[model samples]
Target: MLLPIALAVVALGACDTGGPQIPEPPGPEQPTTPSQPSTPQQPTTPTPPTTGTTGAAAPPGTIAYARGGAIRLVNADGSSDRALWQVPNASLAATIGGLAWRPDGTELAFSSDHEMATSWYERDIYVVSADGARLRRLTNAPALDALATFPKGTVTVRVQNLTGDAGPYFVYVLGAPAPQQVTIPAASSRALTFTNVADLGNVAQPVVVINGTNRWFGDAVADVQGGRSVDAGSLVVTAFGGIPHYGADVPFWRADGQRVGFIGSPTCNLMQVAATPPAGPSQSRLLDPAVFGATCAVDWGPTAATADQIVYVDERRFVDAGEVQFFRVAESARSAGSPLLTVGRYPRITDVRWLPDGSGFLFARTNDLLDQAVNIHEYVFATKAERQITNFTGSFVRQFSVSPDGQQIAFERVTDLKGPSDLWVVRRDGTGARLLVRDARAPAWNPRLR
Candidate 1:
């Protein structure tokens, strides 16, 4: 969830005081609230399960959330809570937000406004391994950057020549730009990288033509994390390719993963960019209905079946309801005709997310068009049915995430709108709701189950 609102300053209490580096803040020794357990109403259904847990053991997966100046991870059952990172000096930094999990669920990325020296409001993207061991800052530009998305996985290809004679070998990632020819000396090797992702096609195929001869290697799935190698005996390598710039607010990975859809900065127009290109690259294109305010609430559908679909807030008005539009990707800049559907009309809108299987989507809207108490709702594509998922009498659902199995949802709820938020988890059917953590927001579920 990419909430563009300014980060509210919250004073921190005494943090760990000892070693050269301060330790991450710990999660509540116990769940801030008591547990509420329920049974699975329909265990066989593909929809979210209607059950909740109350176990002392850590649950099946991880849930990452944001507290004042820190990023914390907790279990679905509210156990094994711990912080991954915390701002060293709260006075110079804003709260950590925009939590996005890598497609493989090995790393988590987010944005923070802590580089006050560059600009009091500068925010940059950062990535941290799931274990919180390796952290890397990815961006340093002075901008209101947020919402960094990743594809299913990245691949690095290592090619070597086992042949007696030295010659040129051609390597290509199907559906990407083109093949590049590399000269390899006999018994020597070289590394090639590919953003082999679905955004370009149904799948990414990495192929290598040996020594410019009809003899070849590959047409292989680039699925491994370390990468595939073609050596004199076989090939090997690893590296993080940088993210492509496409004006950064609320960026999301297309169902295919390699391509990204984001709102362009300054103009607020919808834009698309490939995560990483070849040595040379093509320009990213901008799309229509320059978003109504800077909000540009947007999200990509989850599965390959819905790879080209997107749901976003395209219109806003002071005296009338704002429009949420559903669009399909096209080759042209403006795309074509009308939206496939007008997803909804609301006086105020915030976040939008798709179920893991692409059966439907969840969105946040003000109840009764009152624009005060916001709740999360579900929109099923097949039935064209809409149902309210969260009914907080006077509170708002700020940011929320669907579990990897699509059986649960974790969300941020605040009674005062601008007040400190509490994290809550509930069954997909809207039952068995419970507080998972207090004073936390931006709940992001790990993409894979543990």
Candidate 2:
């Protein structure tokens, strides 16, 4: 079954129609010359407009999107656009939701309708090459396939297979010929096993599982233990109470995957569990109640070696109303603190992604309450400089991705909810902004050597 999407509603209580606007920065004062004889005054050299120093300008790449049961590819500058692939009239009943580019940037994977009769209730994963040369179907089962994450060289998907009246589905890892189902053995019918796979390597390692009913959540990291040729896996269990919901609703994993963190409501208190050997019980620690006192959204930063940060939305009285904040996990661990820094604020932030070097991150920000005005902002941690890349007035942007080189960004912008959302790209310095793809939602940049 497809998961429910979260919606955020903003209510402005009081309005100040006569409030004064913020003034611009004052200009530099003019200097006066001496009365005595002086050398001829030299004209000041005008400064050239600054260009993005990150990379050399190259022909912008192409973007692929799905619209009306057909996949479309467009130039980065919003020109010479064409439909790359289209399904038959019978197969166009299901609406395509998620689309992702392969690590090689040569193929696209998406979830679309599997049948015309059951289009509304059934869906499957499909793949198409970048040039629209080849098409392939990955899954054929009756389960609802969603939340697909394509790692560097491998594709790891979260599949929720509907079984009878119960909703106990298993998450599986697929191989070349067949897919491997990973689950924890249960003792009784009441015992439901909840497992979250943190990271999967090419070699043998333990798969993490959270074993319990719906009351508590835990983490189990697997590793090689026994003399078996295929490495033996061990289980670690950590427990917590008052969990908001299951799946990706709450922030769990730390940057290094060594510890899991979460916040419980209606008090909005923070808790964390460290991964120990022999499956020890979870240790509960409460954070400052004031900082995490509001019901806010949380998300993990991009998984980079140097990127170690957790971002959340916070309310800062009247100044921010609703704003986004970032905290450094490394510093929090050193000082035994909850949060390290409070980054600047944005109107609305979604899908925060870090650059390859971990110097900054890119996120989608909407300025209006209706989410019609949207822009992409890059927040640099080191310099504390935030640059706005796009400024379309009535378009909403989603499914954003940053190039591995941290020079270019890709996203989907839609003018109306009933219309198609096209892909767009711009430089890091907010220059040379243009459209890339048409009618795509989820876009993932390739991290391989390009």
Candidate 3:
């Protein structure tokens, strides 16, 4: 699912997103009156640029979704969908944030309510077996221990947006005896590498790959060992008039762990920053100056060609047609970036993610103003074909998460009523449809996890 916090980086009332750093909907204290029409309809889904390429067909591993107060996993086709685990406090009506599969494919990591705090604000990280046994709390505190991604092992790197306004990005390492926390200040270099775990009493520590422009702290390992608290302040920088240097959108980190990319605050242009070595120097530059009013979706991992290679979507909504262009950049290459794909015309295309094998990507196509219905599409790199993955009407297709193997998908089904969201699973080939639960937020397939 394209989470408000995970993929929906920032939320502007007019451009309000669903990211974690986005502050809660302003309370009644703040008042505003805008031009109104007879219809008081909910915000409609936005359009996504069209992808010329297409293809489809496939299947795989157990898919995990949310229902009631439990995290459930079903077979690829949605059959055998059973409860893997449930939040201990059923009365809390806890909301699941994001789900990540362990590298070996035995356990899953996710963010959910740790207790009955009476608010979604109190979320924590957790790990569970594929069958729903041995549930362990990875984090137990009030802070938001959100966003857990397993690159390729028992290790999971979690991202914490300390400030509600997208301030500091507190990067945490899980799957370790004691998870480590470090803060990357606003504008820190796109790349922040976490290494040298020998000093921290661990034989091997998972590499913490993070992206941003300005990093004030580099020695997070030593700090973690020394018992230091990362005070991820807040975002408070403005360059062009009221444009902020740091917006609510999340930074894009390449799966290769070589570089990180993000949107320039005031300019809205895309910037690529080096994933600086632990406590070392790095560089920051624009991926494309021509792409203005743009922000990145997520890292679909690197192409098989090289670690520097990355496939990302650029949203340039300022132009008359609102272009959503896809580019694959190889830092070592002389060319600024290789333009891979672009939305047909007008309507914006958002939420583009790489398939498991990196051969293609999945995305949603919606009309401008996001009012009309949405259709999910998949593009195959090998075939240069674009195939429609879903068929729905009226309501929108919130988002889709691909499994590690790239055969099956877990996606969100949204309606205008603001009612409970439905969680569904479909094969990559677009067959075998089934609903796992209702009202779940983020649904991620277990990648190859141990």
Candidate 4:
């Protein structure tokens, strides 16, 4: 028998319903004002654009979605919809959530609460073949182990923002020529990035300054490469800003997939860890000299030339509430260089996805003052021009993913925050929008198998 939609999906929300309640694990505290709203609304068909080519035929792959206690799959063309995994009756409140395709696409990894008693459940990772065979439990831990993905490599940096304003802040390695300076805006409160940075050991005294200001902050510099802080005061400080808030959010992967980075919470420092377990121990530091705000989204640039670079969005609340800026942090030499402000600022910008080739990216934004609808848009780095890709009203785009070929996009749309949502596909030029699936919450397309 089909179970009620598993609101207890371990990765999506609180896991206390229908089973023994487990205390949620600690992590980043996401913004509460605008959460990803689930809806039950019907899907809308999009009208094709007059000037662009029709949506390319559905890219070759499968899409995995969960309903009740089962994991299901459907081809990109909406064919062969079938169950991939179903929970056993032996376990109480057993439900599957979270899915990841093995790099070669031969297998899938997921998290589930199938071993729990009716009184309570704990999530664990498991791997199974695409054909639903060779199932193996990978973890039996006491804590949540959902949201599995393959790891990349490792790069680490220590970053902090000491100024008060949301700045286009510059970081200069002490005694370096003007050409060696790195610029990074406070990406919220404790926003940090790198450029022209070297393993300067004790010689690195990083000072930060905002443009058109005489005040600078860097009274304390340490050996960041060693991942330890020290007291060597050589920099001058004329002024300081009030402390900002810090909270955690799901971190984003670097382009090489070697390292994962997130804006640290409570202290607001920019933090990173190796994608996979590193040879040495991982350390955490609190660099909250002052508060910035929050930076919740990041997308790494594509292509070899752009691999070490990234594009992200962060908001500054008081300078006209809802102010958002898009930035690019590029790596030069040992330095990650400065954070370059890209294109235009908006009232809001979220859900950034880089184009397959790194020419630009796709993002979701609210164009009007009422912020009634969030539409998808394309921003080209070469032209610095932006264009709307989806123009539907009264609907909030919950999430979206780009097609492998980069010719199309798949997005979840909701007309009512309290209603159920559906999936839709559209062409790169904003044409040929059509409904793909109904009653689907998270739509993850399978990687193209070799």
**Top candidate by TM-score:** 1
Candidate with maximal lDDT: 1
Model 1 TM-score (2 dp): 0.57
Residue-by-residue lDDT tens digits, candidate 4, 1-450: 111111111111110011111111112222111011122223243443222223464456677765656778877676677888777653456555445454345656555656422101134345567788666543222111221221211122233444454444443432222211344334323323333223333222333333332324333333334333333333322234311111222233445544444433222233444434312113121111123223445555555667666665545431455355666664322322333333232344436767766778878777744666777877777667677777777776655666666766777677764456677766676666676777764455565621
lDDT of 1 by residue, 1-450 (tens): 111111111111111000000001111111111011223332111223223465433346889988767889887777788878776666654657667776677667665655322211133345668888766544321121221221223445666666655555555532223356677776778776655322222222334343311223322333222223321122421111111121234446565545545443333444454433221112143343432222245677677666666665555342354444544443232443565455344445557788887777777777545555677777776776667766666667777888987778898877765577888786777666677887788788988886
Go through the candidates in order and give each one's C-alpha lDDT: 0.51, 0.39, 0.43, 0.45
Tens-place lDDT per residue, model 3, 1-450, is 111111112321111112221111111111100011121122233223221112333345556766656777665544565667877767775566456555455666555544313111234345567777666443221122221221222222223333333443333332222223344443443233333222222212222222232221111222223222222122222222121222222244455434344433333334443333221111134343443224435443534443455565555432645556666665443453545666644544435667766676777766455545555677776666666666565765655677775666677766642445676665566554555555664576666432
Can you list the residue pairs that collide in candidate 2?
A: 206-222, 423-436, 423-437
TM per candidate: 0.57, 0.43, 0.51, 0.51
Where does candidate 4 stray beyond 4 Å?
Answer: 1-56, 66-71, 85-293, 302-304, 317-321, 330-346, 417-419
279: Cα error in model 3, Å: 15
lDDT for position 312 in model 4:
59
Compute the lDDT of residue 138 as modeled in candidate 3. 32
Off by over 4 Å in 3: 1-60, 68-70, 85-94, 106-296, 302-308, 318-320, 330-338, 344-350, 367-371, 382-385, 403-407, 417-419, 429-432, 448-450
- TM-score of model 4 vs. true structure: 0.51
Give the Cα error of residue 297 in candidate 2, in Å.
Answer: 8.1
